[model samples]
Target: MSETGRLILLGAPLGNPADASARFREVLAAADVVAAEDTRRLTRLARDLDVSVPGRIVSYFEGNEERRTPELVDVLAAGYTVALVTDGGMPSVSDPGYRLVRAALDAGLPVTAAPGPSAVTTALALSGLPCDRFCFEGFLPRTPGGRRSRLSALAAEERTLVFFEAPHRITGALADLAAAFGADRPAALCRELTKTYEEVVRRPLGELAEWAAAGAPRGEITLVVAGASATPAQRPDDDALRAAVAEREAAGLSRRDAITEVAAGYGLRRREVYGLVHEG
Candidate 1:
Protein backbone atom coordinates (compact mmCIF):
# COMPACT_ATOMS: atom_id res chain seq x y z
CA MET A 1 0.00 0.00 0.00
CA SER A 2 1.06 3.58 -0.60
CA GLU A 3 2.05 5.75 2.34
CA THR A 4 -1.37 7.37 2.10
CA GLY A 5 -4.56 7.66 4.10
CA ARG A 6 -7.09 4.79 4.02
CA LEU A 7 -10.49 4.88 2.29
CA ILE A 8 -13.41 3.71 4.46
CA LEU A 9 -16.68 2.52 2.90
CA LEU A 10 -19.32 3.26 5.54
CA GLY A 11 -22.70 1.54 5.35
CA ALA A 12 -25.50 3.93 6.28
CA PRO A 13 -28.83 3.15 7.95
CA LEU A 14 -31.35 1.59 5.62
CA GLY A 15 -34.54 2.92 7.23
CA ASN A 16 -34.23 3.16 11.02
CA PRO A 17 -31.83 5.67 12.49
CA ALA A 18 -31.04 3.30 15.36
CA ASP A 19 -29.74 0.75 12.86
CA ALA A 20 -26.62 2.91 12.41
CA SER A 21 -23.65 1.14 13.94
CA ALA A 22 -21.48 2.77 16.60
CA ARG A 23 -18.46 2.23 14.38
CA PHE A 24 -20.24 3.88 11.47
CA ARG A 25 -20.93 6.92 13.61
CA GLU A 26 -17.40 7.01 14.94
CA VAL A 27 -15.85 6.78 11.48
CA LEU A 28 -18.25 9.34 10.04
CA ALA A 29 -17.34 11.89 12.67
CA ALA A 30 -13.61 11.22 12.62
CA ALA A 31 -12.87 11.02 8.90
CA ASP A 32 -10.94 13.82 7.17
CA VAL A 33 -13.41 13.88 4.27
CA VAL A 34 -17.00 12.53 4.04
CA ALA A 35 -18.39 11.72 0.58
CA ALA A 36 -22.12 10.98 0.74
CA GLU A 37 -24.69 9.99 -1.85
CA ASP A 38 -26.69 12.94 -0.58
CA THR A 39 -25.14 15.62 1.61
CA ARG A 40 -28.48 16.59 3.08
CA ARG A 41 -29.27 12.97 3.92
CA LEU A 42 -25.84 12.58 5.50
CA THR A 43 -26.41 15.70 7.62
CA ARG A 44 -29.87 14.48 8.65
CA LEU A 45 -28.41 11.11 9.63
CA ALA A 46 -25.64 12.82 11.59
CA ARG A 47 -28.21 14.88 13.49
CA ASP A 48 -30.36 11.79 14.16
CA LEU A 49 -27.43 9.74 15.40
CA ASP A 50 -25.97 12.74 17.27
CA VAL A 51 -22.64 12.19 15.54
CA SER A 52 -21.10 15.48 14.53
CA VAL A 53 -19.24 15.22 11.21
CA PRO A 54 -16.24 17.53 11.33
CA GLY A 55 -14.93 16.35 7.95
CA ARG A 56 -15.32 18.18 4.66
CA ILE A 57 -18.58 16.78 3.24
CA VAL A 58 -19.18 16.36 -0.51
CA SER A 59 -22.00 14.96 -2.70
CA TYR A 60 -21.52 11.57 -4.40
CA PHE A 61 -24.61 10.08 -6.03
CA GLU A 62 -25.02 8.39 -9.43
CA GLY A 63 -24.90 11.64 -11.39
CA ASN A 64 -21.72 12.87 -9.63
CA GLU A 65 -19.98 9.63 -8.68
CA GLU A 66 -18.05 9.46 -11.96
CA ARG A 67 -16.57 12.91 -11.50
CA ARG A 68 -16.12 12.60 -7.71
CA THR A 69 -14.19 9.31 -7.59
CA PRO A 70 -10.81 10.69 -8.60
CA GLU A 71 -11.20 13.75 -6.34
CA LEU A 72 -11.96 11.56 -3.29
CA VAL A 73 -9.14 9.19 -4.18
CA ASP A 74 -6.79 12.18 -4.40
CA VAL A 75 -7.77 13.13 -0.86
CA LEU A 76 -7.15 9.55 0.29
CA ALA A 77 -3.77 9.52 -1.47
CA ALA A 78 -2.93 12.74 0.38
CA GLY A 79 -2.95 10.82 3.69
CA TYR A 80 -6.47 11.89 4.75
CA THR A 81 -8.98 9.25 5.80
CA VAL A 82 -11.95 9.58 3.39
CA ALA A 83 -15.28 8.07 4.39
CA LEU A 84 -17.79 6.98 1.70
CA VAL A 85 -21.48 6.60 2.50
CA THR A 86 -24.81 6.29 0.72
CA ASP A 87 -28.32 7.51 1.61
CA GLY A 88 -29.40 3.95 2.47
CA GLY A 89 -27.59 0.68 2.97
CA MET A 90 -23.97 0.01 1.95
CA PRO A 91 -22.28 1.92 -0.86
CA SER A 92 -22.13 0.03 -4.20
CA VAL A 93 -25.09 -2.26 -3.49
CA SER A 94 -27.26 -0.70 -6.19
CA ASP A 95 -25.67 2.57 -5.14
CA PRO A 96 -22.53 4.61 -5.69
CA GLY A 97 -18.99 4.09 -4.25
CA TYR A 98 -17.61 1.49 -6.65
CA ARG A 99 -15.62 4.03 -8.65
CA LEU A 100 -13.96 5.58 -5.61
CA VAL A 101 -13.21 2.18 -4.10
CA ARG A 102 -11.65 1.00 -7.36
CA ALA A 103 -9.69 4.22 -7.76
CA ALA A 104 -8.33 3.86 -4.22
CA LEU A 105 -7.25 0.28 -4.94
CA ASP A 106 -5.61 1.29 -8.21
CA ALA A 107 -3.64 3.96 -6.37
CA GLY A 108 -2.45 1.34 -3.86
CA LEU A 109 -4.32 3.02 -1.02
CA PRO A 110 -5.66 1.11 1.96
CA VAL A 111 -9.42 0.44 1.91
CA THR A 112 -11.78 -0.68 4.72
CA ALA A 113 -15.46 -0.88 5.54
CA ALA A 114 -17.69 0.07 8.48
CA PRO A 115 -20.57 -2.22 7.53
CA GLY A 116 -24.07 -1.19 8.70
CA PRO A 117 -27.73 -1.89 7.81
CA SER A 118 -28.50 -3.38 4.36
CA ALA A 119 -31.93 -3.36 2.64
CA VAL A 120 -31.06 -6.41 0.51
CA THR A 121 -30.26 -8.74 3.41
CA THR A 122 -32.90 -7.14 5.61
CA ALA A 123 -35.72 -7.75 3.10
CA LEU A 124 -34.42 -11.24 2.32
CA ALA A 125 -34.51 -12.13 6.02
CA LEU A 126 -38.04 -10.79 6.40
CA SER A 127 -39.27 -12.69 3.36
CA GLY A 128 -40.72 -16.06 4.53
CA LEU A 129 -39.60 -17.57 1.25
CA PRO A 130 -36.61 -19.93 1.24
CA CYS A 131 -33.45 -17.97 2.04
CA ASP A 132 -30.74 -20.63 1.79
CA ARG A 133 -30.24 -19.90 -1.92
CA PHE A 134 -31.49 -16.69 -3.50
CA CYS A 135 -30.53 -14.07 -6.08
CA PHE A 136 -30.99 -10.31 -5.79
CA GLU A 137 -32.35 -8.82 -9.03
CA GLY A 138 -32.46 -5.12 -8.34
CA PHE A 139 -35.37 -3.27 -9.98
CA LEU A 140 -37.10 -4.60 -13.05
CA PRO A 141 -36.82 -2.75 -16.35
CA ARG A 142 -39.27 0.11 -16.88
CA THR A 143 -40.51 -0.78 -20.38
CA PRO A 144 -43.19 -3.48 -20.57
CA GLY A 145 -41.37 -5.57 -23.16
CA GLY A 146 -38.05 -5.35 -21.37
CA ARG A 147 -39.61 -6.27 -18.04
CA ARG A 148 -41.42 -9.29 -19.45
CA SER A 149 -38.33 -10.44 -21.34
CA ARG A 150 -36.25 -10.30 -18.18
CA LEU A 151 -38.84 -12.31 -16.25
CA SER A 152 -39.06 -14.88 -19.04
CA ALA A 153 -35.30 -15.42 -18.78
CA LEU A 154 -35.63 -16.13 -15.06
CA ALA A 155 -38.55 -18.54 -15.47
CA ALA A 156 -36.25 -21.53 -14.98
CA GLU A 157 -34.28 -20.18 -12.03
CA GLU A 158 -34.47 -22.69 -9.17
CA ARG A 159 -33.21 -20.33 -6.48
CA THR A 160 -35.44 -17.79 -4.81
CA LEU A 161 -35.23 -14.25 -6.27
CA VAL A 162 -35.21 -10.79 -4.69
CA PHE A 163 -36.02 -7.46 -6.33
CA PHE A 164 -36.28 -3.76 -5.50
CA GLU A 165 -39.19 -1.78 -6.98
CA ALA A 166 -40.74 1.66 -7.04
CA PRO A 167 -44.07 2.09 -5.28
CA HIS A 168 -45.93 3.62 -8.22
CA ARG A 169 -44.96 0.84 -10.65
CA ILE A 170 -45.23 -2.03 -8.19
CA THR A 171 -48.65 -3.07 -9.44
CA GLY A 172 -47.60 -3.28 -13.08
CA ALA A 173 -44.37 -5.08 -12.15
CA LEU A 174 -46.28 -7.60 -10.02
CA ALA A 175 -48.73 -8.27 -12.85
CA ASP A 176 -45.84 -8.82 -15.26
CA LEU A 177 -44.15 -11.17 -12.80
CA ALA A 178 -47.31 -13.23 -12.51
CA ALA A 179 -47.60 -13.40 -16.30
CA ALA A 180 -44.03 -14.60 -16.79
CA PHE A 181 -43.68 -16.89 -13.75
CA GLY A 182 -47.27 -18.16 -13.52
CA ALA A 183 -50.05 -17.07 -11.12
CA ASP A 184 -49.56 -19.67 -8.36
CA ARG A 185 -45.84 -19.10 -7.78
CA PRO A 186 -45.35 -18.17 -4.14
CA ALA A 187 -43.92 -14.73 -3.31
CA ALA A 188 -43.55 -12.11 -0.60
CA LEU A 189 -43.90 -8.32 -0.90
CA CYS A 190 -42.03 -6.36 1.77
CA ARG A 191 -42.81 -2.66 1.97
CA GLU A 192 -41.65 0.26 4.12
CA LEU A 193 -39.10 -1.98 5.74
CA THR A 194 -37.99 -0.95 9.20
CA LYS A 195 -40.37 2.00 9.00
CA THR A 196 -43.63 2.86 10.75
CA TYR A 197 -45.91 1.60 7.97
CA GLU A 198 -44.01 -1.61 7.28
CA GLU A 199 -46.02 -4.46 5.78
CA VAL A 200 -45.05 -7.88 4.53
CA VAL A 201 -47.45 -9.75 2.23
CA ARG A 202 -46.76 -13.44 1.71
CA ARG A 203 -48.92 -15.08 -0.94
CA PRO A 204 -49.00 -16.41 -4.48
CA LEU A 205 -48.02 -14.00 -7.28
CA GLY A 206 -51.58 -13.82 -8.61
CA GLU A 207 -53.05 -12.89 -5.24
CA LEU A 208 -50.41 -10.23 -4.72
CA ALA A 209 -51.13 -8.81 -8.17
CA GLU A 210 -54.83 -8.53 -7.30
CA TRP A 211 -53.96 -6.92 -3.99
CA ALA A 212 -51.78 -4.36 -5.72
CA ALA A 213 -54.38 -3.74 -8.40
CA ALA A 214 -56.95 -2.77 -5.77
CA GLY A 215 -54.53 -0.19 -4.37
CA ALA A 216 -50.80 0.11 -4.95
CA PRO A 217 -48.76 0.03 -1.75
CA ARG A 218 -46.39 2.87 -0.95
CA GLY A 219 -42.79 3.32 0.20
CA GLU A 220 -39.65 1.33 -0.46
CA ILE A 221 -40.57 -2.17 -1.69
CA THR A 222 -38.72 -5.47 -1.85
CA LEU A 223 -40.19 -8.54 -3.54
CA VAL A 224 -39.13 -12.12 -2.96
CA VAL A 225 -40.25 -14.64 -5.56
CA ALA A 226 -40.11 -18.39 -5.06
CA GLY A 227 -38.25 -20.32 -7.80
CA ALA A 228 -39.65 -22.85 -10.20
CA SER A 229 -40.59 -26.31 -8.85
CA ALA A 230 -39.14 -27.97 -11.99
CA THR A 231 -41.73 -30.74 -11.95
CA PRO A 232 -42.16 -32.34 -15.38
CA ALA A 233 -45.63 -32.32 -16.90
CA GLN A 234 -47.28 -35.73 -17.30
CA ARG A 235 -47.63 -36.76 -20.95
CA PRO A 236 -50.97 -38.04 -22.14
CA ASP A 237 -51.31 -41.82 -22.70
CA ASP A 238 -51.65 -43.14 -26.29
CA ASP A 239 -55.35 -43.88 -25.76
CA ALA A 240 -56.01 -40.41 -24.46
CA LEU A 241 -54.08 -38.80 -27.33
CA ARG A 242 -56.06 -40.89 -29.83
CA ALA A 243 -59.31 -39.86 -28.20
CA ALA A 244 -58.33 -36.17 -28.38
CA VAL A 245 -57.39 -36.53 -32.05
CA ALA A 246 -60.69 -38.31 -32.80
CA GLU A 247 -62.65 -35.53 -31.12
CA ARG A 248 -60.85 -32.87 -33.15
CA GLU A 249 -61.45 -34.89 -36.37
CA ALA A 250 -65.16 -35.24 -35.54
CA ALA A 251 -65.30 -31.42 -35.24
CA GLY A 252 -64.67 -31.15 -39.04
CA LEU A 253 -60.86 -31.27 -39.10
CA SER A 254 -58.93 -33.97 -41.03
CA ARG A 255 -56.86 -36.55 -39.09
CA ARG A 256 -53.55 -34.81 -39.99
CA ASP A 257 -54.87 -31.34 -39.00
CA ALA A 258 -56.36 -32.74 -35.79
CA ILE A 259 -53.07 -34.39 -34.87
CA THR A 260 -51.19 -31.22 -35.75
CA GLU A 261 -53.38 -29.03 -33.59
CA VAL A 262 -53.31 -31.41 -30.64
CA ALA A 263 -49.53 -31.83 -30.93
CA ALA A 264 -49.01 -28.08 -31.03
CA GLY A 265 -51.23 -27.57 -27.98
CA TYR A 266 -49.47 -30.32 -26.04
CA GLY A 267 -45.95 -29.17 -27.10
CA LEU A 268 -45.33 -32.49 -28.82
CA ARG A 269 -43.55 -33.10 -32.12
CA ARG A 270 -45.53 -34.15 -35.19
CA ARG A 271 -43.85 -37.59 -35.23
CA GLU A 272 -44.76 -38.16 -31.57
CA VAL A 273 -48.39 -37.10 -32.25
CA TYR A 274 -48.62 -39.31 -35.33
CA GLY A 275 -47.37 -42.36 -33.40
CA LEU A 276 -49.86 -41.71 -30.57
CA VAL A 277 -52.76 -41.13 -32.98
CA HIS A 278 -52.11 -44.37 -34.97
CA GLU A 279 -50.77 -46.77 -32.33
CA GLY A 280 -53.21 -49.05 -30.43
Candidate 2:
Protein backbone atom coordinates (compact mmCIF):
# COMPACT_ATOMS: atom_id res chain seq x y z
CA MET A 1 0.00 0.00 0.00
CA SER A 2 2.64 2.52 -0.63
CA GLU A 3 1.04 4.23 -3.65
CA THR A 4 4.29 3.16 -5.35
CA GLY A 5 4.45 0.77 -8.32
CA ARG A 6 3.80 -2.95 -7.93
CA LEU A 7 5.71 -5.79 -9.63
CA ILE A 8 3.00 -8.24 -10.66
CA LEU A 9 4.18 -11.64 -11.87
CA LEU A 10 1.59 -13.18 -14.21
CA GLY A 11 1.45 -16.84 -15.17
CA ALA A 12 0.85 -17.39 -18.87
CA PRO A 13 -0.93 -20.39 -20.26
CA LEU A 14 1.44 -23.25 -20.94
CA GLY A 15 -0.10 -24.30 -24.25
CA ASN A 16 -3.84 -23.70 -24.22
CA PRO A 17 -5.30 -20.22 -24.23
CA ALA A 18 -8.30 -21.41 -22.25
CA ASP A 19 -6.00 -22.04 -19.32
CA ALA A 20 -5.58 -18.28 -18.92
CA SER A 21 -6.82 -17.07 -15.56
CA ALA A 22 -8.98 -13.98 -15.11
CA ARG A 23 -6.41 -12.41 -12.80
CA PHE A 24 -3.81 -12.73 -15.56
CA ARG A 25 -6.04 -10.61 -17.75
CA GLU A 26 -6.79 -7.99 -15.08
CA VAL A 27 -3.07 -7.54 -14.32
CA LEU A 28 -2.10 -7.35 -18.00
CA ALA A 29 -4.73 -4.73 -18.81
CA ALA A 30 -4.06 -2.50 -15.78
CA ALA A 31 -0.25 -2.63 -15.85
CA ASP A 32 1.67 0.39 -17.09
CA VAL A 33 4.63 -1.74 -18.24
CA VAL A 34 4.26 -5.36 -19.37
CA ALA A 35 7.52 -7.33 -19.48
CA ALA A 36 6.97 -10.42 -21.58
CA GLU A 37 9.24 -13.42 -22.09
CA ASP A 38 8.16 -13.42 -25.72
CA THR A 39 6.40 -10.34 -27.11
CA ARG A 40 5.05 -12.19 -30.13
CA ARG A 41 3.41 -14.81 -27.94
CA LEU A 42 2.08 -12.09 -25.70
CA THR A 43 0.45 -10.48 -28.69
CA ARG A 44 -1.04 -13.84 -29.68
CA LEU A 45 -2.40 -14.26 -26.18
CA ALA A 46 -3.97 -10.81 -26.29
CA ARG A 47 -5.55 -11.66 -29.59
CA ASP A 48 -6.83 -14.96 -28.29
CA LEU A 49 -8.25 -13.30 -25.22
CA ASP A 50 -9.64 -10.44 -27.31
CA VAL A 51 -7.92 -8.05 -24.95
CA SER A 52 -5.68 -5.14 -25.87
CA VAL A 53 -2.49 -4.13 -24.08
CA PRO A 54 -3.11 -0.56 -22.95
CA GLY A 55 0.37 -0.49 -21.40
CA ARG A 56 3.76 -0.38 -23.12
CA ILE A 57 5.25 -3.79 -23.97
CA VAL A 58 8.90 -4.68 -23.23
CA SER A 59 10.64 -7.95 -24.16
CA TYR A 60 12.07 -9.90 -21.24
CA PHE A 61 13.83 -13.21 -21.81
CA GLU A 62 16.86 -15.30 -20.76
CA GLY A 63 19.36 -13.61 -23.12
CA ASN A 64 18.38 -10.11 -21.99
CA GLU A 65 16.88 -10.86 -18.55
CA GLU A 66 20.04 -9.86 -16.67
CA ARG A 67 20.88 -6.73 -18.62
CA ARG A 68 17.30 -5.57 -19.11
CA THR A 69 16.53 -6.08 -15.43
CA PRO A 70 17.90 -2.69 -14.40
CA GLU A 71 15.77 -0.87 -16.97
CA LEU A 72 12.66 -2.69 -15.71
CA VAL A 73 13.63 -1.99 -12.12
CA ASP A 74 13.97 1.71 -12.83
CA VAL A 75 10.52 1.78 -14.41
CA LEU A 76 9.02 -0.18 -11.52
CA ALA A 77 10.61 2.11 -8.92
CA ALA A 78 9.06 5.16 -10.56
CA GLY A 79 5.57 4.18 -9.28
CA TYR A 80 4.60 2.55 -12.58
CA THR A 81 2.88 -0.82 -12.18
CA VAL A 82 4.90 -3.45 -14.08
CA ALA A 83 3.50 -6.83 -15.08
CA LEU A 84 5.66 -9.86 -15.91
CA VAL A 85 4.57 -12.82 -18.06
CA THR A 86 6.61 -15.84 -19.08
CA ASP A 87 6.24 -18.06 -22.15
CA GLY A 88 4.69 -20.74 -19.98
CA GLY A 89 3.55 -21.11 -16.39
CA MET A 90 4.73 -18.73 -13.67
CA PRO A 91 7.66 -16.35 -13.88
CA SER A 92 10.95 -17.42 -12.22
CA VAL A 93 9.99 -21.07 -12.45
CA SER A 94 13.04 -22.04 -14.53
CA ASP A 95 12.42 -18.81 -16.45
CA PRO A 96 13.25 -15.13 -16.39
CA GLY A 97 11.55 -12.36 -14.33
CA TYR A 98 13.12 -13.49 -11.05
CA ARG A 99 15.92 -10.93 -11.27
CA LEU A 100 13.53 -8.09 -11.93
CA VAL A 101 11.25 -9.19 -9.11
CA ARG A 102 14.24 -9.29 -6.75
CA ALA A 103 15.32 -5.86 -7.86
CA ALA A 104 11.85 -4.46 -7.23
CA LEU A 105 11.68 -5.98 -3.73
CA ASP A 106 15.12 -4.61 -2.91
CA ALA A 107 13.83 -1.19 -3.96
CA GLY A 108 10.99 -1.55 -1.39
CA LEU A 109 8.39 -1.96 -4.09
CA PRO A 110 5.34 -4.25 -3.76
CA VAL A 111 5.45 -7.63 -5.50
CA THR A 112 2.72 -10.21 -6.13
CA ALA A 113 1.77 -13.12 -8.39
CA ALA A 114 -1.39 -14.40 -10.12
CA PRO A 115 -1.34 -18.16 -9.56
CA GLY A 116 -1.96 -20.16 -12.71
CA PRO A 117 -1.11 -23.34 -14.57
CA SER A 118 2.22 -25.04 -13.87
CA ALA A 119 3.52 -27.96 -15.93
CA VAL A 120 5.48 -29.27 -12.95
CA THR A 121 2.45 -29.47 -10.66
CA THR A 122 0.19 -30.68 -13.46
CA ALA A 123 2.57 -33.51 -14.37
CA LEU A 124 3.00 -34.41 -10.75
CA ALA A 125 -0.77 -34.69 -10.35
CA LEU A 126 -0.89 -37.07 -13.30
CA SER A 127 2.25 -39.03 -12.43
CA GLY A 128 0.32 -41.53 -10.21
CA LEU A 129 3.39 -41.78 -7.94
CA PRO A 130 3.68 -40.53 -4.37
CA CYS A 131 3.06 -36.80 -4.70
CA ASP A 132 3.17 -36.05 -0.99
CA ARG A 133 6.87 -35.20 -1.25
CA PHE A 134 8.57 -34.34 -4.54
CA CYS A 135 11.44 -32.27 -5.96
CA PHE A 136 11.37 -30.11 -9.08
CA GLU A 137 14.65 -30.44 -11.06
CA GLY A 138 13.63 -28.22 -13.98
CA PHE A 139 15.91 -29.00 -16.95
CA LEU A 140 19.14 -30.96 -16.82
CA PRO A 141 22.40 -29.72 -18.32
CA ARG A 142 22.46 -29.94 -22.10
CA THR A 143 25.79 -31.78 -22.34
CA PRO A 144 26.02 -35.50 -21.51
CA GLY A 145 28.89 -35.02 -19.06
CA GLY A 146 27.19 -32.17 -17.28
CA ARG A 147 23.87 -34.02 -17.25
CA ARG A 148 25.50 -37.12 -15.81
CA SER A 149 27.28 -35.15 -13.12
CA ARG A 150 24.08 -33.35 -12.19
CA LEU A 151 22.10 -36.59 -12.14
CA SER A 152 24.77 -38.22 -9.97
CA ALA A 153 24.26 -35.49 -7.39
CA LEU A 154 20.56 -36.38 -7.23
CA ALA A 155 21.06 -40.16 -7.35
CA ALA A 156 20.92 -40.45 -3.57
CA GLU A 157 18.10 -37.94 -3.26
CA GLU A 158 15.11 -39.63 -1.59
CA ARG A 159 12.40 -37.18 -2.67
CA THR A 160 10.41 -37.85 -5.81
CA LEU A 161 12.01 -36.06 -8.80
CA VAL A 162 10.29 -33.81 -11.35
CA PHE A 163 11.93 -32.35 -14.47
CA PHE A 164 11.07 -30.48 -17.64
CA GLU A 165 12.58 -31.58 -20.95
CA ALA A 166 12.16 -30.74 -24.60
CA PRO A 167 10.52 -33.25 -26.89
CA HIS A 168 13.59 -34.03 -29.02
CA ARG A 169 16.00 -34.28 -26.11
CA ILE A 170 13.62 -36.21 -23.83
CA THR A 171 14.82 -39.57 -25.08
CA GLY A 172 18.43 -38.76 -24.37
CA ALA A 173 17.44 -37.27 -21.05
CA LEU A 174 15.53 -40.41 -20.09
CA ALA A 175 18.55 -42.55 -21.03
CA ASP A 176 20.71 -40.45 -18.75
CA LEU A 177 18.09 -40.52 -15.98
CA ALA A 178 17.91 -44.29 -16.17
CA ALA A 179 21.67 -44.52 -15.99
CA ALA A 180 21.96 -42.35 -12.90
CA PHE A 181 18.71 -43.24 -11.07
CA GLY A 182 18.64 -46.97 -12.03
CA ALA A 183 16.56 -48.97 -14.55
CA ASP A 184 13.67 -50.31 -12.44
CA ARG A 185 12.76 -47.00 -10.76
CA PRO A 186 9.13 -46.17 -11.51
CA ALA A 187 8.70 -43.01 -13.63
CA ALA A 188 6.03 -41.13 -15.53
CA LEU A 189 6.67 -39.30 -18.83
CA CYS A 190 4.15 -36.51 -19.51
CA ARG A 191 4.15 -34.65 -22.83
CA GLU A 192 2.19 -31.75 -24.26
CA LEU A 193 0.21 -31.22 -21.08
CA THR A 194 -3.00 -29.20 -21.34
CA LYS A 195 -2.47 -29.24 -25.08
CA THR A 196 -4.18 -31.21 -27.81
CA TYR A 197 -1.52 -33.91 -27.98
CA GLU A 198 -1.13 -34.43 -24.25
CA GLU A 199 0.23 -37.86 -23.35
CA VAL A 200 1.34 -39.54 -20.16
CA VAL A 201 3.28 -42.81 -20.09
CA ARG A 202 4.24 -44.44 -16.79
CA ARG A 203 6.80 -47.26 -16.57
CA PRO A 204 10.11 -48.31 -15.13
CA LEU A 205 13.01 -45.90 -15.69
CA GLY A 206 14.92 -48.44 -17.81
CA GLU A 207 11.93 -49.39 -19.95
CA LEU A 208 11.03 -45.71 -20.39
CA ALA A 209 14.56 -45.09 -21.60
CA GLU A 210 14.17 -47.87 -24.14
CA TRP A 211 10.76 -46.53 -25.14
CA ALA A 212 12.17 -43.08 -25.64
CA ALA A 213 15.08 -44.47 -27.60
CA ALA A 214 12.68 -46.27 -29.87
CA GLY A 215 10.50 -43.15 -30.26
CA ALA A 216 10.01 -39.99 -28.24
CA PRO A 217 7.03 -37.66 -28.32
CA ARG A 218 7.07 -34.23 -30.00
CA GLY A 219 6.17 -31.61 -27.40
CA GLU A 220 6.99 -30.26 -23.98
CA ILE A 221 7.70 -33.14 -21.52
CA THR A 222 7.70 -33.35 -17.74
CA LEU A 223 9.19 -36.46 -16.13
CA VAL A 224 8.24 -37.63 -12.64
CA VAL A 225 10.40 -40.29 -10.97
CA ALA A 226 9.76 -42.24 -7.79
CA GLY A 227 12.13 -41.78 -4.90
CA ALA A 228 14.51 -44.49 -3.67
CA SER A 229 13.09 -46.73 -0.97
CA ALA A 230 14.73 -46.82 2.44
CA THR A 231 16.71 -50.07 2.58
CA PRO A 232 17.50 -50.47 6.28
CA ALA A 233 20.59 -52.52 7.08
CA GLN A 234 19.76 -56.20 7.73
CA ARG A 235 21.54 -57.16 10.96
CA PRO A 236 21.56 -60.81 12.00
CA ASP A 237 19.79 -61.64 15.29
CA ASP A 238 21.67 -63.15 18.28
CA ASP A 239 20.92 -66.71 17.24
CA ALA A 240 22.00 -66.11 13.64
CA LEU A 241 25.25 -64.44 14.75
CA ARG A 242 26.10 -67.29 17.20
CA ALA A 243 25.41 -69.89 14.50
CA ALA A 244 27.63 -68.01 12.05
CA VAL A 245 30.40 -67.90 14.65
CA ALA A 246 29.98 -71.65 15.20
CA GLU A 247 30.12 -72.40 11.47
CA ARG A 248 33.21 -70.27 10.85
CA GLU A 249 34.97 -71.56 14.02
CA ALA A 250 34.23 -75.17 13.02
CA ALA A 251 35.68 -74.42 9.56
CA GLY A 252 39.09 -73.68 11.12
CA LEU A 253 38.49 -69.88 11.25
CA SER A 254 39.42 -67.49 14.06
CA ARG A 255 36.62 -65.65 15.95
CA ARG A 256 38.02 -62.38 14.50
CA ASP A 257 37.70 -63.67 10.92
CA ALA A 258 34.34 -65.16 11.74
CA ILE A 259 33.11 -61.76 12.97
CA THR A 260 34.33 -60.19 9.70
CA GLU A 261 32.43 -62.78 7.66
CA VAL A 262 29.24 -62.29 9.69
CA ALA A 263 29.54 -58.52 9.54
CA ALA A 264 29.99 -58.49 5.77
CA GLY A 265 27.17 -60.96 5.30
CA TYR A 266 24.75 -58.93 7.39
CA GLY A 267 25.98 -55.55 6.13
CA LEU A 268 26.98 -54.60 9.66
CA ARG A 269 30.23 -53.08 10.84
CA ARG A 270 32.86 -55.45 12.32
CA ARG A 271 32.67 -53.64 15.65
CA GLU A 272 28.89 -53.99 15.64
CA VAL A 273 29.20 -57.72 15.02
CA TYR A 274 31.71 -58.11 17.80
CA GLY A 275 29.49 -56.20 20.24
CA LEU A 276 26.48 -58.28 19.24
CA VAL A 277 28.43 -61.54 19.75
CA HIS A 278 29.86 -60.49 23.15
CA GLU A 279 26.37 -59.58 24.55
CA GLY A 280 25.22 -62.97 25.91
Give the TM-scores of the predictions, in the order they appear.
0.80, 0.80
Cα deviation at 6, candidate 1, in Å, is 1.8
List, residue by residue over 202-246, the lDDT tens digit for candidate 2.
776777899888877787888998776566347657888888877
TM-score of 2: 0.80
After superposing candidate 1 on the true structure, give the runs of residues whose Cα lies further than 4 Å from its correct spot.
231-280
Q: State, as a TM-score between 0 and 1, how close model 1 is to the true structure.
A: 0.80
- How accurate locally, in lDDT, is each candidate? 0.83, 0.83
Each prediction's number of clashing residue pairs: 0, 0
Clashing pairs in 2: none
Q: Compose the digit string of candidate 1's lDDT tens values, residues 183-207.
A: 7676779998888888888666887
Q: What is the lDDT of residue 256 in candidate 1?
A: 61
- Give the CA lDDT, 0 to 100, for residue 239 in model 1: 87
